[model samples]
Target: MAEIISDLRQDDVEDTVPGGIAADRLRSIIERIEKLEEERKARGDDISQVFAEAKGAGFDVKAIKQLLRIRKQTTEEVEQLENLVDLYRHALGM
Candidate 1:
């Protein structure tokens, strides 16, 4: 992969576009980006399927997503946020 990228870069320098950037190089870069975007979409579909399976198993998808977000934060950050929520709830009498 590294060799392929290096070769592409080498060929790119020889075929400059109007603004000094090689047209081939620009095309290569765009193609690589497009391929990655397609892969990302496929991965997103896979994740959605997993979420559907979890829902079918009786899990609450919304709460699961919230838990996923909470797990991304530090424990101290979560505690601080929860404390703030509790304080706000108390003030609101809810």
Candidate 2:
């Protein structure tokens, strides 16, 4: 894949000026970024499949997502968020 890109941009690589941008280096960076983007999409799809499986097993997907979000936070942050929710609920007479 990289070889094909390099072959197509051979002219750009050869025509690079001294002290100017390096075409080959730039192409390498762009190719790496594109590869990472593809991997990220694949991982996203995998996560969606897992969530679907959880839903099929009769788990509350929304609560699972909330748990995931809370797990990423500090304990103190979770406490603070819970306190705020309680305060709002009290204010609303709930």
Candidate 3:
């Protein structure tokens, strides 16, 4: 299995030009993307931890998340959404 993997890597090297600049650039781009993805995952975990702490503190996590979503929206957008919700509620006698 090790020999097969080595052979495959050798074939890949052979396919690239002698200078391998393109291959090196591609590798660098891929490594940077992987690093960013890892960082994003860590940040997500931190966010989840904060949410857990909020829940433990007796805050409603769902409402907090909803507020965060609303905070990201513009005032005009929120008013439009609220109007739509009110219209729909009235339609349904809610």
Task: Kindly provide the TM-score of model 3 when superposed on the true structure, using C-alpha atoms.
Answer: 0.78
Instruction: Please list the C-alpha lDDT of all candidates, in the order they appear.
Output: 0.87, 0.85, 0.82
Better of 1 and 3 by lDDT: 1
| lDDT, candidate 3, 1-94, per-residue tens | 4453354454466555554434654577789999999999999999999999999999999999999999999999999999999999999999
**Native-structure RMSD, model 3:** 8.4
Q: Please give, for residues 1-94, the per-residue lDDT of candidate 1 as tens digits.
A: 4455455556576797665566776687899999999999999999999999999999999999999999999999999999999999999999
The C-alpha TM-scores of every prediction are 0.83, 0.80, 0.78
- lDDT value for model 1: 0.87
Q: Model 2: how far is 17 from its true place, Å?
A: 4.6
- Candidate 1: list runs displaced more than 4 Å: 1-11
Candidate 1: deviation at residue 55, Å? 0.6
Which whole-number lDDT from 0 to 100 does residue 20 have in model 1? 58
**Error in Å for residue 58 of model 1:** 0.5
The alpha-carbon root-mean-square deviation between model 2 and the true structure, to one decimal in Å, is 7.5
Cα RMSD for predicted model 1: 5.7
Q: Write the per-residue lDDT of candidate 2 for residues 1-94, one digit (tens) a residue.
A: 5554445555565645664455676678899999999999999999999999999999999999999999999999999999999999999999
Residue pairs with backbone overlap in model 2? none
